[model samples]
Target: MLLVDFVLLSIIVGLLRKGSLKKIGEIPIRKLELIFLSLIIRYLPLFLKGSLKEYVVQYILVVSFISYGLLLYSLLSNWHLKPLRIVTLGVLLNFLAIIANGGKMPVSLLAVDFAGLGDFKQDLFNPLYPYHVAMMPKTRFKIFGDIFPLPKPYPNPKVFSLGDVLMGIGVFSLIQEAMLKKKSASDKISRRKLKRNL
Candidate 1:
């Protein structure tokens, strides 16, 4: 939800800067389907919790790693884009944290309480949850976990990780670049026409 907010904000900012919406389509993002496939693989286990729940749980880590690999590969395919490089770095940070913690993201209990989601504590601790685990003394790479709290009065408060922040910034920058680049090109053409008329 917070990420969605970031995207909306980016679009709003771009429009305010006199950027054209059509310019976003000009971005040379390659292999976009891999990102969707990665997401599908990551969440597929969540919906298969009836007949193959046990099997899914047992192999969830493998599934996660594979999904991350696909996502990374797709992101790397657009490595020439500076904003995407930052986004890829953020994803790499998350990948390292998950791998270090035995395939589950560690969530800080304190952060959950701060975010007014205390009710979710039990789910965080549940072994079958398959996505997040409660942060503890034994949790590895604690710095990379979801420890930052975004408390209420905000629209969609939630606990987020450092990597999430980086990704948001990267996305915002990407949109800005697309918007401004288009505007600058148009301005140059207009100036050339004015010089010709003069």
Candidate 2:
């Protein structure tokens, strides 16, 4: 995931350096600001501490999803393409999985217990409450269980699926692209000013 993010960032920066998005640079940064804010808010659940944190995180999740959806809608209104579609699908899948699993991806409690997660009430067990009931898609229509993760040697490797990987890549790609475009526009503006002065 990190490697993919780095590669996407590099590509975006390279494109920006080429001044491909110079014209679009003049547009207001409000849209970009929303995206950046959303990114920060989306991850707040993982770091929040204390009893009230869960409620706070849940509220933030709802708001963040709505804001993100709106932001995507606004961005796609002016831009459309195959790459965007692929990224959108990945994001939607990830969101659905999260929502289906109680706003957080469920990990195997047994797996965690075996890994020596001493206290089950800690932040690590935030995914699922009890041993049997997991915030995950179960076999039955109404049941939900942490039926994810393939059989691996590690007891508690972060059990993320293929959808998550794709989503992460898409997110990284989008951010890198935006930053590169902004930087490129700034450089082009500077060059134009220099030419005018000369």
Best by lDDT: 1
- Give the number of the best model, judged by TM-score: 1
TM-score of each: 0.88, 0.49
lDDT of 1 by residue, 1-198 (tens): 456777899999999988877888889999999999999998887887665876876777898899999999999999999999988988888888887887788999999999998877998878777788899999999999999999889877789888888888888899889877844688899999999999
lDDT of 2 by residue, 1-198 (tens): 332543455466656577344433443434566666656666555566766665665455474466457656644643543345445565555555555544554455554454454454275444322112243236222212233333336433333444545555655555445545544688899999999999
Collision count for each candidate, in order = 0, 0
Mark the regions of model 2 whose C-alpha exceeds 4 Å error after superposition.
1-30, 58-64, 107-124, 127-159, 168-198
Q: What lDDT score is found at residue 198 in candidate 1? A: 100
Candidate 2: lDDT over CA atoms?
Answer: 0.49
lDDT of 2 at 102: 42
Per-model C-alpha lDDT, please? 0.87, 0.49
